[model samples]
Each structure stands twice: as structure tokens, then as C-alpha cells.
Target: MNSQQPSLAQGLLAGQRGALARAITWAENADRRFPQLLEDVYAAVGRSHRLGVTGPPGAGKSTLVNQLARHLRELERTVGILAVDPSSPFTGGALLGDRIRMEERTLDPGVFIRSMASRGSRGGLARATVDAFDVMDAFGFDQLIVETVGVGQAEYDVVGAADTVLVVLCPGAGDGVQAMKSGLLEVADVLCINKADLPGADRMVADLEEAVHIRTAGKGLWMPPVVSVSAGTDQGLDGLLEAIQSHRAWLEAEGRLQLSRQEQRLDQVQRVLREGFDHAIWEGRGLEGYARAMIKASRTPHGAAERILEQLKAALPSEWAQVQEETQP
Candidate 1:
């Protein structure tokens, strides 16, 4: 809300890239002015297709995403790329590997690429990644590609934020077995066998196809297609696009897209509320110091936490009961 700075909400509505950048920074920093900007620009969201790309390290995700963004620009689609990289522990900043590799796209006006630090988040994404996505969507990008830090089976953070989850795997990694054990196959809307020119590529593709066939068979579920692509050589990119489009069509059928988005929105709301309330109780209300004092007096950490919860319940009886009931499994 600096007087010298232009109104970010107004600038975002006007499609100014500088405003978009600043707004995303505000999201990253939890700036006080962000809520107003979000309120002003929220109606412009929901038009872009969010595609989440994730895989284990060394899977060539950045290369594939660079190629995809270039192709999208050729098709006249404005693209926003969020590359969430592992944070440097010393500085809590992005490694910038993905941004360095995507130098060509930086010059293109249609492609806005931002590199984000994961900041020790386990789910493959930075905490503010989804907030940045919303601002980019409001800026009128036709597509938003969120590339996660190379992730394992359990770090499937992109699932809730993306409309399509694209799982990328390369040959010679034993990723096929890992995918099954990690349940990567469960969250994937499309699977890409990247580095298709390498050895074992075809075998990996076949194995994944068989896996998909088995898991989806007799359940009437949407079978995630296995696509083989050498993004390095730019081979079979069109087929990848087709596979994604087919999934999009399936999701669009019978209001499935609407329902899925609604559920994800609800999840986002719950996460935000939980985080805010926890912070308010511990930090804002001086409970953090009290917890420490209780620990010093021989109370276990769990016991201190239970005492704090009891205090909160006493203060807001009906509200606390509703929260507990809603959170019950």
C-alpha cells in the first residue's frame, strides 16, 4: 500500500507483467496488502488450465517443461510457468536450475516463468506456489504449468492444486516399480516416459501401460495413458498434447471438472484456516511462551499442547465442537 507504488490490483486487471510479478512476490512474503489484491482480481481467475508436472530427481522435468512452453507459445497460448526448486538451506532461495534452463522462454512476452524456492516444504511445492498460480491465472494466462521439485511417491503436493497431474518418468530408473509402491500411478492423469531414445524406454512404457490397464480394468476408471517422448529430440510432443487433451475432455464430461475443482477449493480453504488459527493461537496469543514455560515445569510437549487445546475449547465452546466434528475422520 505504498503511495508511490501503483495499485497492484488495478495493474493486474490491466495485464501488466510488472504488477503480476509484484503481486506474486507479495504472496510469497505474506504481505499485508495481498488480501485486497486477491479480492480485487479473484473474479478473473479460473480460466487457465493448471497442469502439474512432477517426478523424481533427474527425470528431465525442466527440459520437458521448457519444450512444452515453447510449443504452447507457437499455438498462441499465453503460458505461466512456476518452477519450484529445492531451497538452498543456507539462504532459503531457489537453486534457479529450471530458470537457467528456460532462458529462451524468458524473452517471450507470452511466457512468464518464475522460479520458487520449496522452503523445506515436503509436498514438492513451495507454500505460496498456489497463491502465485491464482495471480497468474487472474493475469489471463491460458495455461499454468507448475513444475515441482523432483519428488518421491509420497510428496505428491501438486495433486490438489492442478487440474491435470502429469507424472514424468525416464528410463533406467526403476521408476516403474517405485511408481507402483509410491502410488504415483494413483494421482497421475497422464504418464510420460521421457528420454524415450534411451535404453529400456519401450519396456518401461509397456510396463506402465500394463500397470495402468490392471489398475483401471473392471473399475470403470479413467485409464491414464502412457506416452513416450524424447523431449530432448522433441519427439512425440504432439502425442503428449493429445493425451492431455483427452484427459481434459474426460474431466469435462458430466460436470466432473466442476466437482473436482469444488473439492480442491474446499481443501485449500481448510488448509488456510487451519494454518491461520494455529498461528494466531500460538504466536499471536502468547501461547508459545506459555507452552515453553509448561515444558520447563515438567509438562510433556503433548500435555502442554492438550492444555492449550482445552483452553481454546473453553473460550469458544460451540465453534470448537464444530471444528472438531468437521475434522473427525
Candidate 2:
């Protein structure tokens, strides 16, 4: 741990907003001190119920998220919102300022909102979004809502992190067809048809419900409930909230909440391992030279990769080598 990490972690645990912000920034930048800070505050995590909102662009996701935060606040719950925006190509910063709509909640001390840039991460979420959520969780928010950059198919990461995932769609945007064709239904715990006042909203709802029914049929444990809402007018917001609450209740009743989180943590570990291996082998170990040498020797890329993997395997501890050998066919 660094000299300042302990104090930062303490401040975060004490509910100091500045410290929470700093910790989230550290997570965003993947700072060296973050792991230590996370360790220090690890006990405080897992108290918050995480909800992820995701969909295609202009689906009123931000509006719905803002309204959800307000609704949660009305229930006397402390809310932490992570609104992820697409990255700017040049500066790698958030392209859209999502905080603009969330201005009402900004002044409330009980509500904390942070905007994160996707930074071209493969998922609609920023790579560090779960880390940021963890720090916020440790900060003692009762509810944590992550509003993903409304990118279509690549938004599955949010589902893996959140306790409930609301896939928001709206009329006149090809949203219904896109949601069905892009496999968004597979990831949704609740399907929200926003802008319900529009012409095709009911038809969109019917299409989604049929799709959800067809997909679930007799196999899945939970069939996602489709709800319609006009976030702009705040209509049917209660129904959306109720659906989320119902899903959470179902997860808890079925003893799957903890199981889901355990799986998510394992996924996080895999991502960290991949990143650590990439940095250690390519950057720290100067294995780029090995690749160049193999190229010069007329070795195929796959052959070079196999040789590197063999070297890596050989360098493992004896116990790991035995385990690997035992696992191999």
C-alpha cells in the first residue's frame, strides 16, 4: 500500500464524497494504489443493490436512469450513479456530458453521480466500471445504478456486474427489431420500452413480450418482464421500478444473488489475469523481441504463439505444471 492509500480508503469509508470521487478516478485510470485501497475497504462492499441500464442510442436510457435515481432517493435510499458515455476519439474523454440531465440529483448529498468514458472498451461499459462501482459500494450507497453508453450488442458486461439489468428501448428507432435481433433479450432482466406515448410503443411492447416468451418458454428460471414507460413524462416509472424490485426479490428468494456476485468476481479475476499477463509478457519481459526473432526465422504467428505459451507453461511452479498436465486431455 502507498502512503496515501490508507487515508483515502478511510475517507471513503467515512462517506467523504471527495475521497469516493478520487478512488473512482484511481479505478478509472487503473492506478497502482487502487488495489490496496480496494483491499482496505473490501469489507464495506456488497451492501448496495446494483442496477444496470443499457440500450441503443437515444433510447432515453439516461432520462430513465435519472428518474430511477430520483425514485430511489424518494425511498430514502442513498444512490450512486455511474453514467458511462462514449469516448472521444481524440482525447479519450466522455463525448457526451450525461450529467446535464442529472443536475437535479447533483445537489442532493445523498446522491452521487459520476460520468465515465467507455474509452473504446469492447463492452458498452468502461473497463473500470465495476471497479468504480465497487468503490462506490464501499462508500455505503444503498443503491448503485450504472447507465451504460447506449451501444447495442456489446453491452453484456453490464449484465454480468449488475444485480438487475434493464434493457431500455423506445419507439421509432428500430429499437424493437434491433433488440430482438441483437440478442439483447438474452441479457435483460427487465425490458423497458421507453417513450410509450409514441405511435408504435404498444406494438414494440408486444413484439418484445413475444420474443421474451419464445426465448424463455419452459427453460429459463426468470422470464423478463416487459414494461412501457415515457421517461420524458415520468409515466410508468413506478412499473419499471417495481419490475426491478421484483427481479431483485426473485434473485434473493432463489438464493442466486450471492451466486451471481461470486460469478461476477470470478469474471473480474479473469480480466485482471489477462491484463496482467499481457503487461508482464509483452511490456515488462520484452517478449516483442522474441516475436520479431520468430518472424525472422520464418515461423508462423501461431507457431510463435505456441512457443511463447510453452515457455510460459515451463516457467510455472511445479504444482501449477502438475495441475495443467492433469487437466490436459
Model 2: worst 10 consecutive residues (lDDT sum): 173-182
Q: Model-by-model lDDT, in order?
A: 0.86, 0.88
Against the true structure, whose lDDT is highest?
Answer: 2
Q: Which candidate's TM-score is highest?
A: 2
Q: Write the per-residue lDDT of candidate 1 for residues 52-137, one digit (tens) a residue.
A: 99888989899999989888888999999999988877887665678877899988999999888888677899878888999999
Worst 10-residue stretch by lDDT in candidate 1?
A: 1-10
**Candidate 1 residue spans exceeding 4 A from truth:** 2-6, 293-299, 317-329
- The C-alpha local distance difference test score for the whole of candidate 1 amounts to 0.86
Query: lDDT (0-100) at residue 92 of candidate 1?
Result: 71
TM-score attained by model 1: 0.92
* Residue-wise C-alpha lDDT for candidate 2, range 1-329, written one tens digit per residue: 57898999999999899999999999988898989999999999999999999888889888888999888889999999999888877787666688888899988999999998887786889899999999999999999999988776756888777999988888876755675787778889999999999999998898888888888889956999999998999999999999999999999986799899998898889888888888877785578888777767656888877877787778888898678889997
Clashing pairs in 2: none
RMSD of each: 2.5, 2.1
After superposition, which runs of candidate 2 have C-alpha atoms over 4 Å from their true positions? 175-177, 321-329
